[model samples]
Target: MALAGVRVVELAGLAPVPFCGMILADFGAKVIRVDRTKVTMAMDTQARGKRSLALNLKTPEGVSVLRKLCVQSDVVLEPYRKGVMEKLGLGPEELLKENPRLIYARLTGYGQSGSYAAAAGHDINYLAMSGLLSMLGRRGEKPYAPLNLVADFAGGGLTCALGVVMALLERSQSGRGQVIDTSMVEGAAYVGSFMWKSRSIGMWNNPRGENMLDSGAPFYDTYQTSDRKYMAVGAIEPQFYSQLLHGLGLDDADLPSQMSFSDWPKLRQVFTDCFATKTQAEWRAVFDGTDACVTPVLSLEEVSSHPHNQQRESFLQDSQGEESPRPAPVLSRTPAQPCQGRDPFIGEHTRAVLEEYGYQPQDIDRMLSTGVLECNAAKARL
Candidate 1:
């Protein structure tokens, strides 16, 4: 309920911007996603708790409707490359002139003014440009794209959401709005700040996969169990390492020094052979309540039943019976809630939203009839 009464106009986009808008919605903002007319909808986790208003932005009337929404919204999260919104006459300058208190947040791959500002890009492209891509993956393998989590969600979405909250807090004092130019490349670099800063002091002086945290150390990586399942291990400190050794029934005298990089291959083989003797469940039982910092590597299907995740109610099922992660960083007094039933279909609230904005029913009907707006009439596919 922190963002209760806050209205956000989210121009429907791909992963990052929608994720940022979802964060705002999770914290009680009234988020209206301006979706393209006839967009295909599937099981949308990011669309949770958002109202959809499908509009043909190619039309002048549709653009005017969007402008009206922006003029009345507290925040506008746009996900286009530079000048895309300006071409539609809904740029920050135009809208902020009409509404000085609007927080105009732009989520893009490159930025508004950089040389690559208008280049086509996805999460992988952004990560490569951000300089974090070179530091990921195994020792000698080509850098593995980590499923887009680094740039798309953590860096771009989470970073923009944090910026939006900070801007809202500042707006309470300044009584004015400002533009937030959030570039995914820059945001990814900022999120990987520790990796960048630590290298200066030799924390990451080694090659990409040779660092302690990046599976360089035998104790800080995953091991395959007898059942072909995996267990994640992070026994870095001496005490934890001792526990890990004990859990594996290995004597300290038989192993090399914990931090001896030269002996990691041998240590890792010893660990691999030890772990292969037991199933993941057996290993989990060995280290469950200990300080070994060992845990099973849960698959998506297994996450809902995991004890810690279940204890915290970290995931909840939607109307589709698909379990997805819940709103995070729980607040005591005003905790977030799951979507009551289902996310809106494209343009599910098109007419209702127009009426709420004081548009006449006749006008809305005319817009719908003229292809300026759209409402959900077809049955949703699952």
Candidate 2:
């Protein structure tokens, strides 16, 4: 694997941090999550393929142990509010000094140095602040948040992972690592570059749901079928649009011009009525191998059974029957794999990790006894 032998010390946090670590781990990096001894397990699905080391960083012994691990690790991922790590004396300045080649990454909603850096915010707030949220939804409806995928996972986690890989590539040439400051707000805006550029090209001046790709055209929207299930249509090109009309049993001579904005409402109604005449499955069969660019809008439960998804193994089920998406962007020679192990309980590998970091068995025992470290006895028994 591309990231084999790379060691990552991940400070446990929420979605973005664990997601970044997961991407690295999927590619064969050794990821050790530094969890808090007193905290409960986070609701982060990205925790798979990682080992946990629970320690109380408030204690000097815990801090000392983390510093030692950072010294031997290639990357240190921190996702705290700005200045929190600095207050804890574990900021980039301190950790990078111990390992000059360590990539110290910080992920946050705002950024390290911004007016709203210290303010509390979530994925929606970040997307709104980035102006991307204002462009979503129908014309008369309020802009809808596209779940948490945009800012949290895509902008924050995926962007940070890319930064880590780029930094590592640079490190091979410079033999030195650097800091990566990632803000979800900025990253969200960056990923929406096409939307911003469209405005300048006169292709995006209309309000939400009134633009070419924003469901303004009848050919690029979803229609309800007779069974109430939906079918998504993206027959944008002239040839594809002809295919869509042919499948709908309509001819160009019987309809208004395709590019006539004033005719969209009528065209949409015609398309909607035609789609409502058939069940989604019926429409799917009609467009299955055609260039109509029509597909069913599948529910979460239906996705795993889809023929294409099953053939590609896009989602993998674990031994416990819990399903999760597999690593993507398939590499021909060194494809990434799903995490082989289940998510670790808190402090499951504390003793082993400490010993690997050169701490004596006696020292680890003392730390555990003194409340500086913790180990999950149940996991240890296993």
Candidate 3:
């Protein structure tokens, strides 16, 4: 719980915003998500670990409510187009003027000042722009979309959260706040640092899946088993690759050597033909405790029920059987744990939060009546 006692107000719509809130909430921040009055609970995992405060930003009173919350918050995370927050009258300038130490983080598809800042885009577009999408998948095939994990979570959500924490730490000394404009595309590029270095040295090629880590090496790729299950291999070093060869009972003299690009196709065929002899489980048993770095590619369902995950309590349960994905890196002390609640229904905590903020009962009633805040009395919808 690195952010204990801190209060974070998340102005969220989708994806990264909710993820940033989740990270903040996991570490004990009082995360209050100001969500659209119309969005539903079932569609958003990012809304987990926070009290909901629904506001109709179409109304000026809604903007004022968020402004007040901004004044009281230590951090504010907004993932919108460049001008959307400014139009809402709760932009960084106004917010920082109210509280100089507040960490204001803005996440977007491109970035704050880029030419395409206001353009519509998604994870795939950002990944494409970073030259990362060009390096995924099998040789001579189209680049595969890596679900939305890269740009949305790794590049956008996680990066924005990291920036907020960094700014928060810096603010402790300066007592002055700043704005962080995080572009998902730029973040994606930052993540592909090795690719950039390779490009500089002319080791990079734009063709899909021809690079070493991108299925170019037979020893560092996925192979299908007899049961149609798959396993990953990572015998990158010569010694490890030798162990892999030995474990598979393949003769070094019979197989093509590593680094012989001209013979890689022939080597891959031999390896693939050999792997087809066994199921993924059989392959796992053979390499179980070896340094060859092989692993069965478990499905999501399998991972949820995995023994190692269960032993470590990696997944956490809510009232629903579904659990939070994975607990983060372990800390020596003050380990993070799961919050009991799921994503709250829209405005589920409006009245309660208003009360906690010292709004008098009469003021709360007036605000509710005046359309300043809204709440759902029913329990959160799954």
Identify the leading candidate in terms of lDDT: 1
TM-score of 1: 0.97
Ranked by lDDT, top first: 1, 2, 3
TM-score of each: 0.97, 0.97, 0.95
Please give, for residues 217-256, the per-residue lDDT of candidate 2 as tens digits.
8889999999999999999999999999999999999998
* Best of the two (2, 3) by TM-score: 2
Note the residue pairs that clash in candidate 1: none
Cα lDDT, all candidates: 0.91, 0.90, 0.82
Off by over 4 Å in 3: 39-42, 200-206, 379-382
Candidate 2: residue pairs that collide: none
Write down the RMSD of candidate 1 (Cα, Å).
1.6
lDDT of 3: 0.82
